[model samples]
Target: MKDLKDLTAIKLKAYTPVKSIRTSWNVPISDFARLTHNPIRAIVEGLKIVPNPDKQLIALSIGDPTTFGNLKPAPEVVEAVRRVIEDGSSNGYGPSNGFLEAREAVAEYVAHQGAVTPNDVILCSGCSCSLDLCISALAGAGQNILVPKPGFSIYRTLAEGFGVECRYYDLMPEQNWEVDLSQLETLIDGNTAALIITNPSNPCGSVFSKSHLKAIINIAEKHFLPIIADEIYEHFVFPGYEFHSVSSLSEKVPVLSCGGLTKRFLVPGWRMGWIIIHDRDNHFRDVRKGLANLSARILGANTMVQGALPDILRNTPTAFYDDLVSTLYRHAEIAYKSIKQIRGLRPIMPGGAMYMMIGIEIERYPEYETDLDFVQALIAEQSVFCLPGQCFEYPNYMRIVLTVPEEMITEACKRLTEFCEKHYKMDDRIILQQQNGLLARMNQY
Candidate 1:
């Protein structure tokens, strides 16, 4: 219809050109990328701390029970995974939520969480992912979630990653790290979306009793807010102390409990965790749908691990947990008694979990201004590494894992005592020494 010259001119005029690619990198990172800082990694890794060159380092910093080779999963737990791999049942893709059988197994195992069912279970990569799903599903930009002060840093990392605000409620160290109900209530306003309760807490190792748990649930019920119960350390309580799941204590409040095989089975690398919905009243009607949608993003957790759930949950003997708890209990006693003798450090006796929080009389250590400075000095002079409280958003305190071998803990405490004595202010050291002597004499009676 047109001449060749006219057609060529028309094509050239209509043609669109793409903007040229930039010569230099100027990509903008999303707010999630820029703001999602894990306080633990940031504080622990950011500090270029080097241990004493001359001494063998005794690290009480790691929370993993398997780090020192003193702990291992039961044989049946490993064999379950092996059987699943050999059977090839889990080789194919599973439902986005999880395999039905795995969900059922989890439901039955966590029956204590209050009448769970397969439909209510969503398998996740680990407790961390389970927590992420809960945080992202329940809270959104401009809303806030109440977290414990001196709490696990993962909550902040997950919340900020989703643009959710984290408001901390103080946990009283003097009251065995119990939640300050008054403070917790004050943190809640219309913008508050949920509350996170970490029982047998990671940094505190303080397990909530049934009554104490009920008190917390009452607050949630009163505020008409749901709860994100991080129960990864469930049932890890030492003897004489019982561990109660926050979900179990709730009747009116909906709870999304995050738990996993990572801690209990001592197979953290397996990355198997679950969320059990305990809505009872269907408060999570939309939340359940939201969780399912979020899970589709990852296509679900490892199928092999899912397949092993039934066997691992049913076959593992009770004695396995009993023995493990007994070992941890003994370790706790040893560390508590040893650290109690240190002049400037006051150790909080943990009731459960494998960690203890020690309060430092920073004023007594005149040379060090904060827990970080004190911890750095401890590592340099004594080759003993303890996590500074700044890692948990608490200052002038430190946390140590009780999962280390007994002899290592004993030796580590000895070193800690020596280091504290070296830097302790002269007058306070003498006064504390007298107090320690008086207490030791009183105990002798």
Candidate 2:
């Protein structure tokens, strides 16, 4: 009749509910572990658990560009790495903030935004890691952080795991995914520590205009919250639009801008990214110290990549970027036009990044229950893969990457179109009744 509390911490393993007890030294998983796990990876794994030999799945799920296997790093960057291997200095430990040379290079690259120097840059494994560091440093247990509703889920994942709550602010899809200022102001309270924004956003893919960027800055300044600008897609804007850094517009508020070599350099595996401290007024002195303390525990980015970064930043030809961005522009056009051609699916033409957010009309396609059901059924039938809006915490929508080669994208769209055609329905009532009944009928080839 003795309770489990009577046992010591070490002996408490015997109180485990399962058949087996910890006979030796054992550890239990933390509640935070489940929250911290990447939902994207889990979804991908869930979809792949069962192997269908007949159906060929075309992946547009993961955002890593290198998965295409066609895009390669600049020759100079490869050569620089080769040289680093020969020299063997970068093979050893370097500064925690980053190699001074690498920081200087990132400083020079981002200097166009504002006055920047090597002292302002802190490098990490990648933009994701930099974001993790920033979010963890800024907010502690029980505090709240404002994030975009359809934003990258990692912010929420990490925030929740760290015991910080995440509050979502709506982005107006009708107005090209701009933040709803009124909704944003309403979400703020004393517990809110920082506001996270992704420019050239993921999932939403809409780049903020200079005016909008200034408005965001003004709001942050008014509320005294530092901005975590996720600028990983910096300079990835298409023909008509330009990427503007929020930090460039003002000096009153602090900006911890995170970016990486992943998208722009076309080498995500390089794992090199940095945080640029844009505190022109020295307002973030304590924040910078917190970042320094956290970064010190992790050391820095890949030294070989760090060694190559300077050459990669300075020597990469202008034509290289021009061609890459232009190609992305064309792909975005193809995706936008193709999505428009399809009934019941409305797509917002992206200004930058490589994604387009497509709004799904569930009433039009009553066969599927939600965006997740739509994509799952699409993959099951047509073998076309896309992340549902649920992955980004915004349901009734789906996100597709347009940066894949044009022919591949065209063909994927063709398959997506076929999938829609296969399940097309004029009447929602019949489709509703047929959810289980007609689903099999539609799946029949």
Each model's lDDT comes to 0.92, 0.85
Each candidate: RMSD: 6.3, 8.3
Q: Flag clash pairs in model 2.
A: none
How well does model 2 score by local distance difference test?
0.85
The top-ranked prediction according to TM-score is 1
What is the C-alpha lDDT profile of model 2 across 216-246, one tens digit per residue?
Answer: 8889989999999999998889877888888
Model 1, stretches more than 4 Å misplaced?
1-24, 426-445
* TM-score for each of the candidates: 0.91, 0.89
